[model samples]
Target: MNWQQAQKDFEHFLLIERGLAKNSVQNYSLDISKLINHLSTNEIRVSPTKITGEILQHFIYEVAKILNARSQSRIISGLKSFFNYLIFEGYRDDNPMELIESPKTGRKLPDTLSLNEIDDLIAAVDLSTNEGERNRAIIETLYGCGLRVSEVIDLNISDLYFQEGFIKITGKGDKERFVPIGEITQNYITQYLENSRNRVSVKKLASDVVFLNRRGNKLTRAMIFTIVKNLALTANLNKNISPHTFRHSFATHLLENGADLRAIQQMLGHESITTTEIYMHVDKSHLREVIKDFHPRSNY
Candidate 1:
């Protein structure tokens, strides 16, 4: 099959079969496009089913000059998944990427914001304007509930259980989970709902959406990132931050305060406890405290 048709089929497979998020699917698509670009630039005309690991290795070698180990690894991983799909569909015999080795890249810890930094970022929001209330609520939900940007944007008015002190989040792959909301976060969201959001004229489809644009449609993920970026600039904080920095800070802060990792995992909707365990590494002092407080023979 031609590169275009192969990529189109791969995209459909990822979305329909694997149920990957849009950004994730886009990343996989980008990797295949890069490979196609490499083949075209080198004047190597080869079909997807006929391409060998040797040509892929050559492409990897060229990419290694510009991409770091982590990026190279991700590209290799994406390509492998794509070709594996081809194999599963009976479009090819043996997987061409079977023998290809991904470059070794160590686990990179996510960046987290300090409590003071998070506070300053929220404090920087202009509360006088109509959108200001909405912005504050967005930050609070992100930090308080550890909601991903997509989850926050997709939040519905029906999903809020204020009396229960929890918010329902639709996470990756359509997984649903309940996350507890703090009093402060609840208050901010309530105020935004009662005041700013009430003023907006919402679209029919987005009537149940909690956060909305001025025109009352569901907010884009990019808008949330832009909000965080502007707030960072207004706060004059030097660290580069995003909506995710708040989520990381949420888990990290909870772990530092002796909250159970499993509980945090449930709230964050992480499928694996290993994903939640990264917070344990964030605060070594907490680990030392756990040893001193709980371990037997600590006095010795």
Candidate 2:
């Protein structure tokens, strides 16, 4: 089959059989497209089933010259998954990326905000306007629930179980998890819905959506980023902050406050404890406190 057909089938598998999010599938497709573009540009004649490791290596080398280590690593990883999928479908006998190695980019720690900084950020939200109330609720839900930006945007009014103190989040691959919502977050949401959201003429498509734009439509991811950026500027936060910073802060703060790692994993809807363990490195003092308070040898 041609490279186009191969990539199409691979994308279908990623989206349908693998249940990957659209963004993830698009990334995988883009990786394959880069390879396809390289072959066309260089006038190389090889189908996906017949492509050799040498060609892939040359492509990766070209990529390394243009991209950083992290980006090159991601493309390599993405290509590896595509070839593996071809093998799984009996289109190829051997994987091309088996000998390839990713560059050693050490553990990149997530940036977190201290409690005082978080308070200041939230305080920066202007309460004089209806949209400000919605923005405040958006920020609160993000930090309070440890939700990914995507989850916050996809949240619906039906997901809020305020009486049970939980908000249902639809995370990556459409996996659903109920994370506990604190009273403060619940109150903020309640106020937004009752006062601001109730006043807006919501679009039918976005009627059930929890967060809406000025047009009463669902808020876009870019809008969320803009909101966070403006808030950071207003708060005079020196750190490069995003909506994700709040999520990192949520996990780090919980871990530092003696919350169980497994429990934090559940709350964050992380598929693995290893993913949650990154927060352990965010605060070394928390580890010291754990050892001092709980280690049997601490009595000495």
Candidate 3:
């Protein structure tokens, strides 16, 4: 099939068959679009089925100059998924990316803040303003429950179970999990919703959304980043922090305190324990302590 037709079909498959979210489908399409752009720029005319592994490899090499290792790896993965779909649909005889190797890169550990640093960051918020209160709740929920930025923004008031001491989080791929929320965070969110959020004239659609912008709309991912960056600057934290840092910190802190890895994996909404194992790497000293304390006859 032609590049354009293949892209259209791939999008349909992702949305209709795979049930991927719009952003995910867009990302997959964007990966293939990069190859289409390369072909157009180089004046090479070839259909998707006719494309060879060598040509794809050359395109990836060209792309490596513009993207970092992680981004390039993501692009390769996306392309591989797309071609695999095509193969399933009988559009191609075999996958071209089967032999393509992602660049060798170590797993970069996420930056984590200590409890005192977290308290300092929260204290730095200017509560005199309406947005400040909402921002406080945002940060608290992020750190307290180990939530992804998307999950935090998309959080609904109905998802909260303060009486049960849990908040239902809808994670990647629309998977839902209940995470325990501490009393401190629960009170902060309650105060923000009751005082600040109540004062704003929220839009009809955003009424259920827990966090809102000044215009009474749901907060965007960029807005969350801006809030966190400003707070980090105010607190004078040397560690480069983001919303994900809070999540990493939450998991790291829990793991350090001897929380079960499987339980943390469930709370973090990770489908596999392997993904949760990253936290083990974050605290080698904690692992050593565990080994010393738990191993039989360890006194020696």
Residue-level lDDT tens digits of model 2 in 82-122: 99998999999999998989887788999999989988988
Model 1 residue runs over 4 Å out of place are 41-43
TM-score of each candidate structure, all chains considered together: 0.93, 0.95, 0.95
Error of 2 at 228 (Å): 1.1
TM-score computed on alpha carbons, candidate 3: 0.95
Residue 147 accuracy (lDDT) in model 3: 94
Each prediction's RMSD over C-alphas, in Å, is: 1.8, 1.6, 1.6
- Write one digit per residue (lDDT tens) for candidate 3, span 1-300: 789999999999998887776778899999999999999999999888878889999999999999999999999999999899889989888999999999977899878899999999999999998788999999999999999999999999999999999999888767789999999999999999989999899999998999999899999999999999999999999878889999999999999998999999999999899999988888789888887989997888
Per-residue lDDT over 1-300 for candidate 1, one digit per residue giving the tens place of the 0 to 100 score:
799999999998888888887778899999999999999999999999999989999999999999999999999999999888888999888878878888788787889998888899889999998799999999999999998998999999999998998888888878789889989999999999999999999999999999999998999989999999999999999988889988999999998998888999999999999999987777689788888999998869
The stretch of ten residues in a row with the least summed lDDT in candidate 3 is 15-24
Ranking by lDDT: 3, 2, 1
Worst 10 residues of 1 by lDDT: 278-287
